[model samples]
Target: MPPRPRARTYDPAKTRAAVTAQLEHVRDAVRGLGEEQLAAPTRLGDWTVRELVAHLSMAVGAVGRHLERPAPPAPEVTATGWVAATAALGGDIDDDTRSLAASAAPAELLDRAAARFAELLPQAPGDRLLAARVGAMRLDDFLVTRCVELVVHTDDLAAALGTTLPYDRQALATATRLLADALAAKAPGGSVEVRVPPYAVVQCVEGPRHTRGTPPNVVETAPLTWIRLATGRLDWSEAVEEADVTASGERADLAPHLPLLA
Candidate 1:
């Protein structure tokens, strides 16, 4: 078997700042919601806007909760691995988000979550291990995953409300890079060049390797479009039909390897 591709690295401080900025963006948008808007449905199964908003708090604030617990011994997941590990967790996540949505108003839930996150962030180091829901991971790695949760769900929240929320530059870039790397890990090779400009580029899918110049297979798209595709928010054929993604070469059809996370 071919060796596993090395996961890309992320800076913990930038990740932390991105998470904070994005959460504030979510909080700001949610604060203006009326009951009617909150009841609107999102593309994420049965979750309505309210449930989706509540889930952001649960997702980002998990850091503080983990820090309060006993440290786990060793790392078991990386930012890329977390993407592969999350598909099996849908049911549990749904239950938890529903419970959270029912417990408090979106504004209240997010405010408290944000306050706690800010209070706890400075107390620990990046290498501090936390037993994340997927597996034990360094605080730094886990923070990187928060980029995915915030950026993707923020997109969900916007789609549900028909509004655009601010995308923190670092948060969007980190999530884009993490998911891009996840794609490489999912289908390791060197035949295709997948690029999300101003953020990441990775080669994957086994074939004749491209040592230089134009690769035989190439796929390129905007970062948000790439994130939506990687998370199954956008369909492969549909993206191609609409010209949201450009593909070249037979090996470049990525429909068979997508939505690395549910």
Candidate 2:
């Protein structure tokens, strides 16, 4: 892989708030589900709503668990790199998620995990480096990764349950910006401008550069659609066919750079 770009900075406080808020959003939705709903299948291959919820707890719980370990000397991965790296660990994650789901009531599991996360996050230092599967990342960067996890999987839960789970605005914005920046890092150019309204606008792809005026190549979509596209939840052509995304200009085709994170 190409050298990782300089990691983006996130406000420590906002990240902490976002993580908590998004998790609570999922928690509230899960709390109201009946047994039948908990058993409903999700799009994440063989995982049910319960298992998906269990996995979400694991995602947030990771922060506290890592903080309990000895701090690492330095960070081993950039925030953007975490996105692409996750695809390789799918099998392990699936097994662990299933196991956790089977071990506790979904509501109980989520509550305990959320409580622990809430307790630990405030006490942790933002600059402290924690051991991550990818490598050591500062608490803040790791938390931003949590925003991506919470936001993306929350969408998964919503789709499975056939209900809208409201996004915490800061959480959605941070996740959107991180993924958009990841695309720019992956392509490394100013040839294409990708706009996710109200949150992110990034220039990417390698070709003729646009300095000012209307960008020669432009691709735009809503924030949720952009998230789905970046995370591989939505196909580029399918999104375009459904009118969910709009691209204009010869070099604006982003199929080659899309789903920046698997």
Q: What is the C-alpha RMSD of each candidate to the true structure, in Å?
A: 0.9, 1.9
Give lDDT tens digits, candidate 2, residues 26-131. Answer: 8899887899999999888888999999999999889888988999887888788788788788888889898999999988888988889978877888888989
Each model's TM-score?
Answer: 0.98, 0.96
Stretches > 4 Å off in candidate 2: 1-7
Per-residue lDDT of model 1, residues 1-262, tens digit only: 5556665778778889999999989998998799999999999998999999889989977989999999998899987889999999999999999999999999999998899999999888999999999999999999999989999999999999998789999999999999999889888889889989989999888888888888889999999999999999999999999999999998999999998887
Identify the candidate with maximal lDDT: 1
Pull out the clashing pairs in model 1. none
